[model samples]
Target: MFFADNLKFLRTRKEKSQTAMAEELELKRTSLIGYEKGVQPTFGVVMKLADYFKVSIDALLRYDLSKLGKFELSQIEQGFDVDITGKKLRLLVTTTDTNGEENIEMIRHQAQAGYTQGYNDPEYIESLPKFQLPFLSRNKTYRCFQIKGDSMPPLSDGSWVTASFIQDWNTIKNGTPCVVITKEDGIVFKLVYNQIKENQEIMLVSSNRSYAPYNVSIDDLAEVWKFETYNAFEV
Candidate 1:
C-alpha cells in the first residue's frame, strides 16, 4: 500500500510531529510510525487518516491511477437524474466558436426569464442545455457571471465566467487556482497554498507574481470552489 509514503509526505509537508499528529488522531506514535513505514492500516484507520488529512481515501492511498477505472464506474452507478428545483446551477462555457457564443446567448435568455418570473411563476425552473466540463468528470450545472478583477489575470477579466459548486476539497491541490468563499467575503478566486500549520490559517496565493499572498483563517471559509477553466471576452 502507498499509505506509508502518503502519510510521510503529508506529515513532512505539514511539518507535523508524529506524536502531535498521533495525539490529534488518537493513534499511538508507533502506529503512526508503522503507517509511515509502509504498514497497511485497517480500513477504519485509513478513513480516519484520510479525514485528518482532508483528503479522499483514494488520494491518501495514492490509488488514483489504479482506481480511475473503478472510480468512473462508481460515478456511473451513482449517477441519476437530478431535478433542478432548489438545486444550485451555473453555466459552463464549452467552446469559443459561434455555437458557443449562441449557447451563451441562450443562457442569458433563461436568466432573463428567471428574473422576470413575477410575470408568471417566480419559482418556475427554466430548462437550459446541460454540458459536461472537461477535467471535472461530473456534469456541472453552471450560471454565467461577469468577471470584474485582474486577480485571475489572463484567464478571467471583464468577461463571462461559468461558476459551479465544488463539493470536494481532496481534489484541490496546493497552488491550484480556485474560487473561495469566506463568511466575511462571499467569493474570491485565487491560488490556494497549503499553510505550514494545521491551524485555521491558509495562504491565498495569487497567480500574478506582482501580488503578495494573503493569509486567511480556515474558520472564516464558507466554501472553496475550483475554477475549472474560463472563457474570456476580449475588451
Candidate 2:
C-alpha cells in the first residue's frame, strides 16, 4: 500500500526517470512502472530495490518513507529504519549496555551541534556519554540534554533535563514542556503548543515571560522529547 507511493516519491526525489532508474537497478522499465502503479514486487525484486535505495525491506514496504523529512530520509538511506509509525516520523538512534538494557545518552551544550546531524547515526549515539536512571521506565527511550540560558527559569542554565522520546507528535498536549530537536534550532527546551492539526506547525514558548513564542513547521522537526524531570544545578 505505502510501497507504491513511497517508491514513486523516492524516485521523484532522486529525479530519476523510470527507464534510467530501472536500468540502474537492472529492472525492466515496465516492471518498475508496474511497481509504482501498485503491482506487487517479488521478494528478490524487493531486495534489489531496497539495496538500490539503501533502505530496509521492512521500511520500504511498511513505512511511508515519503512523509519523512530530509534528515529522516538520510537516516533511512543509511539503513537505520525508524520504528515509529504515522505521518511525521523520525528514527531514535540509541545504544544498549552489555546487559542489553537501554542507556540514556547525555547531550551537553558542547555536543548539541553535532547531535542535530548525528541523531540518527548509531555510532555517533554510541559515542556519547551514557547512563541509566532507575526511576525511568525501561520500555521507553530517554535522553538527557543540558539546558542553557534563562529561557526556562526553574530548570536553570547548565541543568540536565532527562526526557523521554515522543514517537507521535500528535500526542503532544498543549503547553507541554518538551525538548524539540529541529533543523533550524539544534535543540531547544520549551513549552510546546501543538498546532500540528491546523497548521502543520508547533508553537514553541519559553517559560520566561521575556522570550516570545515562535512557530516551527513540523517539516523542520527532527525529534521531540517530553520533559520528564531535571537535575537543577546549585545556584
Number of the top candidate by TM-score?
2
Cα deviation of 210 in candidate 2 (Å)? 0.3
Listed in order, each prediction's TM-score against the native is: 0.40, 0.64
lDDT of 2 by residue, 134-162 (tens): 88888899999998889998878788999
Q: Taking the tens digit of each residue's C-alpha lDDT, what string does model 1 give over 76-149?
A: 22442111111222222233334543222113322433423321232332243334344543455333444446
Q: The CA-based lDDT of model 1 is what?
A: 0.54
- Those runs of model 2 whose alpha carbons end farther than 4 Å from true positions after fitting are 1-89, 232-235
lDDT of each: 0.54, 0.86
The alpha-carbon deviation from the true structure for residue 81 of candidate 2, after best TM-score superposition, in angstroms, is 18
